[model samples]
Target chain A: MANSIPAPRAEGLHYLGLRDDIARRIATGLLGPGDRLPAERRLQADLGIARGTIREGLFQLEAEGAIYRRDRSGWYVSPPPVVYDPTRWEGFISYVEAQGRRPATETISAELIVADPLLAGVFGRPVGAPLYRIRRRRYVDDRAVLVERIVIDAALAPDLLSHSLDQSLTDILKSVYGLSVARNQVSMRPCALTGEDAAALGVKSGLPGLHVQRLSHDAGGRVIEFDHEYWRHDAVRIDVDIRVR
Target chain B: MANSIPAPRAEGLHYLGLRDDIARRIATGLLGPGDRLPAERRLQADLGIARGTIREGLFQLEAEGAIYRRDRSGWYVSPPPVVYDPTRWEGFISYVEAQGRRPATETISAELIVADPLLAGVFGRPVGAPLYRIRRRRYVDDRAVLVERIVIDAALAPDLLSHSLDQSLTDILKSVYGLSVARNQVSMRPCALTGEDAAALGVKSGLPGLHVQRLSHDAGGRVIEFDHEYWRHDAVRIDVDIRVR
Candidate 1:
């Protein structure tokens, strides 16, 4: 069997060269965001490289967040990721727009439910207390980037669910409910995307994702809201500047 | 050919149950960190479930950071991840020890190298300027969890490479070089582990990893060190606290 198997091709350098070539095109804006790359066969014919070598190069670019493969579809150039600053109180729309990307939000579901044990602990509420659960998907440059699940004290805003849920929750709480966000506690880790979140972000299940959990506090330091956000691994970068002194 | 395939087993609920069972055990300390799980054959016999179902459950647990599989080895419980607060001026050893885990470091390589274009831009040094490059692997509970590559201006820290390179670079700079870290600019995103980083962490290549880049500035507001860290996705969580007022 060993003798029958073909010798592996020496495509290491070829694949690296292909990767750099594509990367340079992206950096120069010749391959804009969401622009599809040449098909594998086309790439092989154009560059005179093996199909496997082209695939290796594409995978490397995907790992570097330069391009992504859609299931059953070809590769497309990835948009530049937005920077997330946890210390800043700016909403997603503000920061994304500041970076010259269009931002939009869609409300998937909004309802009032009894607090679960986990939510109760996080919100310092009774387990049976009523809370508003809102699920929304956010987009940057028309690409779904993250899914956010937010829970707020229903009593704090009686008619919150009746209003538009697509807007920023921070603004809603401040302008409509007279509740200002004074502090935020955030924790983040990387994990595999769940099936539901993956569908929301148009990615494959089990792909790597960034999970961010936050607790928002009122002026008196009372926990007012809790949120869980699942972001496409390549869609956002967490930036934190610290002054040690 | 389609009919030749066997009907898929209804193992979804079973696998989830298995995942919950194992998670509960880990939470209760019945299965401690680094403890090898029962063999798959044993689990199949004990649970009376198909091998595929057991594997699915294991994969889910791994995604949740509860357990991991060593290549060619059985599954093992994962340690609780350590929390990293960029705002705090704490070394890895101090923080890992504070979390009740043993921390160790191994100097992989230390040398003087001419700054490349990327390093020159990051360090504000002229191209080809000499800089000290240090690569080290960090461990928690005897498990390699992160690899760090650090570049420092050679002129500022003369004979720095002569001392031990396995200890905390922050402490060394503070005590020996009279430089205190006063500011840090940190950026992090999820990425696929490269071959070199995966080998250093004793994992398979292409596994999900967390890539962190940091620029450390001293009290004089000069960039003193630029560091790149590749961490096991399951090994650490980033936390940030902000006061909006």
Candidate 2:
């Protein structure tokens, strides 16, 4: 792999060629996910490229999501961004695991709460209806990527708080309650992280993120779950295939 | 509308109620796309809410993608984010129009360029293949929202530069060259705008944006279009519904 790496081209577009060389290293698995790149000064010494050119190439790669900077930390190859498909019935754990990444969910809290007026309006249920509120943070490659708050119709799954709340909630819904997700109404928007969410994701408050809300229904079309998800913008790419029904 | 709006709640979470009020205005069409809100001082006076409270509410709405703040230009209601469905054969103009928004395209440049090694590998063609390069900026509601650079095989469309490049390239390919898009391979990631792109989109360089690259194949499975799109992060949302194939 080292022998095949090309030398930088002429001065005018040396950064482009340098970018290709680094991208090749990433594509060939020579630089795996979470592997930190050498410092800019060190890389400059090794490649015999000017610091400016090296910085430009690194900036381009970061913009392309091929790598990311962890604040004061150095640059590291980015994990493949998770592809979220709303139309599939496959649970999140199954699909994320299918991508050859370790997927883990940590329950932050789970408790029963009466629906607020806003929640009632969203769920179309009467105010004061009992709802099971769950907050969990999901991780990929040991990095926290997603924080979700879910509210379930407590009547449908009684004593839900007593059951294990880790792993895939969709799977638990099926095995414990005989419910399957029939469809999901998902909405996505770009947002900045709130202070609490920023702390959870290890980023400063007001850093841009992605906000995704999913309202999933059961096979009988009963509203089963309402989920609000906040994701680090750099950690995922969204893909959807729209076919004629 | 005034009577329907609920007054702010107690002192502690006053911003929450104000945010709900502003969100309701957006949802009810009281504040249409591109409609600018009152200045912070005026809003504070009208709502009898504190200035800090008003600012917090506005901040929340911006994070929710319901509105946006233009640098030095004040706040405005955001147009509904376009829903791009790659599976449908509809051209960019039609789907955006179907959502009741006017779509316009401005051609920035068109020329013939020899394919570089990267382009040759991506298109599965030999190097030096003549490719038609077209650059365009797209608008909705007269606001620049997307900038795209397309590279197409020039051998398939002779004299392509002579045709109007201000509309959907897919439509032009179908009508002028009898080439129809069969399917697309689309990938999206969060990106910060480049200096050139930032100048075009009227945003600061390094502002987070959505980077979408698409490879579209013709009916006979020949790759016809390679489109790279950059969009302002606040102006658009990405949603894709996946169904079992």
Give a tens-digit lDDT track for model 2, residues A56-142: 787667656677777678888888788866667776788889988888999999999999999898777899999999999999878
- Top candidate, metric lDDT: 1
Alpha-carbon deviation at A82 in model 2, angstroms? 3.6
Candidate 1 residue lDDT tens string, A1-245: 11221222344366667777887899998999889999999978777777877787786777667788788788999887899988787789899999999999999999899988988887788999999999999999888889999999887888899889887878888899899889889999987776689888888555567899999898988888899999988899999887864
Stretches > 4 Å off in candidate 2: A1-80, A114-130, A218-220, A242-245, B1-89, B155-159, B218-220
Tens digit of lDDT per residue, candidate 2, span B1-245? 12322566554466777777787888898999889998988877776777876876776676556677777788899877887655677777998899888899999889999999999987888999999998999988788888999999998888888988997777778899998877677777777776688878876455567888888887676888888999877767665543333
The lDDT, on a scale of 0 to 1, for candidate 1 is 0.84
Alpha-carbon deviation at A137 in model 2, angstroms: 0.4
lDDT of each: 0.84, 0.79
